[model samples]
Target: MRRSRFAASVTSLLLATGLALTGAATAQASSTAATGGYVALGDSYSSGVGSGSYISSSGSCDRSTKAFPYLWNAAHSPSSFAFNACSGATTDDVLAGQLGSLNSSTALVSISIGGNDAGFADIMTTCVLSSDSSCVSKINNAKAYVDSTLPGKLDTVYNAISAKAPSARVVVLGYPRFYLLGQSCLGLSDTKRSAINSAADYIDAAIQKRALDHDFVFGDVRSPFSSHEICSGDSWLHSVNWLDIGESYHPTAAGQSGGYLPVFTANAS
Candidate 1:
C-alpha cells in the first residue's frame, strides 16, 4: 500500500507539470500568431479593384493577390489569412457576402464599403460629367443612407465577427480619392470629385466611430493619400503613361504598402 501511494503521487506530479508546459507553449504560439496576422473584409478598395491583383482563382470575392492585406502579410508573414473582400459590395454584403470565411482564429479584419450602396459609381459617371444636379442629389441620398443604414449593417458585421473571432481586432478601411478635386478628367467637366471624396470621408468617419464603439481599430486611408491625389504628379494611383486613363484612382503598390499597411499593422496589434 505504501508503494502504490508513492507511485500515484509521482504520476500526478508529472501530469501536472506536463499540462502546465503544454499550456505555456500554446499561449506562446498564439501570441506569436496574433502579432502580425489578420483577416480582411470589405469591398473593392480592400479587394483592389483596378489594382490588377488576384488573391486566388477561387470563384468567391476575387480578392486581390496584390491587395494591402496580402502585402502586409507578405511583409510580416502572418500565420493565416481569410480574405473575403469583394468589389462593388455594399455594407449588407458583409453578412450576405463575406462572413463564412472568418473564425475564432482570425487575428484581424479590414473593410471598405458604402460606395456601391449609393450607386456612387453611376453618380460619378452621370453627374460629375453631366450638367444635371441629379448626381448631387444622388450623392446626398447615398450619404443619408450611409449615415443611417451603414451603422446597422456594421453592427451586424461586428457581432458576427465577434462570434467567430472573440480575440481578433477589426479594421474598417475607407476609399481613396477617385477623382481630382479641381482637375478635369477625360471628357468630364465640373467634376464633383471633392464632393465624392467628402462623402467617402463621411462614410470613413462613420466606420471609425463604429469601430470605437466596438473597441475595434478604424483604419482610414484618406489623409495618407491626400498628397498623392489623382492627377497629381507622383500620384499613388494611375499607371504610368496614362496620366488620363489609369482608373484615375486606386492605390499603387507603394501606396498600399505605405498608406494602408501601417494602419493594418497598428490596429492588428
Candidate 2:
C-alpha cells in the first residue's frame, strides 16, 4: 500500500510538471502571434528617395532597405510588412494606390504625405529659378492652400485611413525644415530658406491637426532634423544632388536612420 501511494504521488507530480511546460509553450506561441503587423504607406520621403540603394522590386516607389519602415520592421520583427509608399505620390495617390494594403488586421501604419499635395516640387523649382520676393510670394500661395484647401483634403485621407485600419495605430509623420533658419546654401538666400521652412511648418501643422482629429499619432521630425538642415555643415538632407535630381532635397541615409527612425519608433505604439 505504501509503495502504491508513493507511485500515485509521483504520477500526480509528473502530470503537474507536464501541464506547466505545455502552458509555457502556449504562452510563448501567443506572444509571438501578438507581435503585430506593420504597413508603411506614403510618398517619396517614406519610400527613401534620397537614401539611395532602392529595392528593385519596388520600382518607381524607390523603397530602400535603409528606409525607416524597413529599419523599424527589422528591429521589431512585425508579423508582416508591406511597403506601399511611392515616389511623387500625392494625397490622391495614397487614396487610389496605397490604401489597399491596409485592413483591420494591420496593427501599425506610418505615413509621410501632403507635401506633394501642396505642390512642394513646383514651389522648390520656382524658388530656385525666381527672385526672393517671387519665392516668398509662391511660398505664401502654398501656405494659403494649406490653410484653406488642404485641411479638407487631409481630412478625407485621414478619415479613409482610419476606416481601413480601424484597430491599427496610425502615425502621421511630418516633413522637416529643409534649411536652417538663418543659413543659406544651394543658391537659396536666408529669406527664401526661411520661407521654405515656414511652409514646412505650415504643412506639419495641418497634418498634426488632422492626426489629432482622427485620434492618430503625429511623429514630428523637426526636432530630430533641427541640427541637420540642408544649410548645416553636417546636414543629413541632400542639397541639390544634380546627378540624381530625383533625390535632391530629400533625406540622406543618416537622416533616415538618425532622424526619421527614432521619431517613428518612439511614437509607434
lDDT of 1 by residue, 182-263 (tens): 6544533343555666667777777778778988767777777776766666577652123212233456665666666665
Summarize candidate 2's per-residue lDDT along 1-269 as a digit string, tens digits. 01122233434433555520112211222122136678899988899888988999998788988888877776677788898988888888889999987888888999998888787876776676679999899889998899898888888888998898888888899999999766545567888888989899889999999888889889999998988998788898876564565677789888988888888877776
Q: Estimated TM-score per prediction?
A: 0.76, 0.86
Runs of candidate 2 exceeding 4 Å displacement: 1-34, 184-186
Candidate 1: worst-modelled 10 consecutive residues by lDDT: 19-28
lDDT score, residue 209, model 1? 86
For model 1, the superposed segments whose C-alpha errors exceed 4 Å read 1-37, 179-191, 238-248
Count of clashing residue pairs in every prediction: 4, 0
Q: What C-alpha lDDT, on a 0 to 100 scale, does residue 181 get in candidate 1?
A: 61
lDDT against the true structure, each candidate:
0.61, 0.79
Error of 2 at 127 (Å): 0.5
Error (Å) of candidate 2 at residue 73 is 0.8
The prediction achieving the highest TM-score against the true structure is: 2
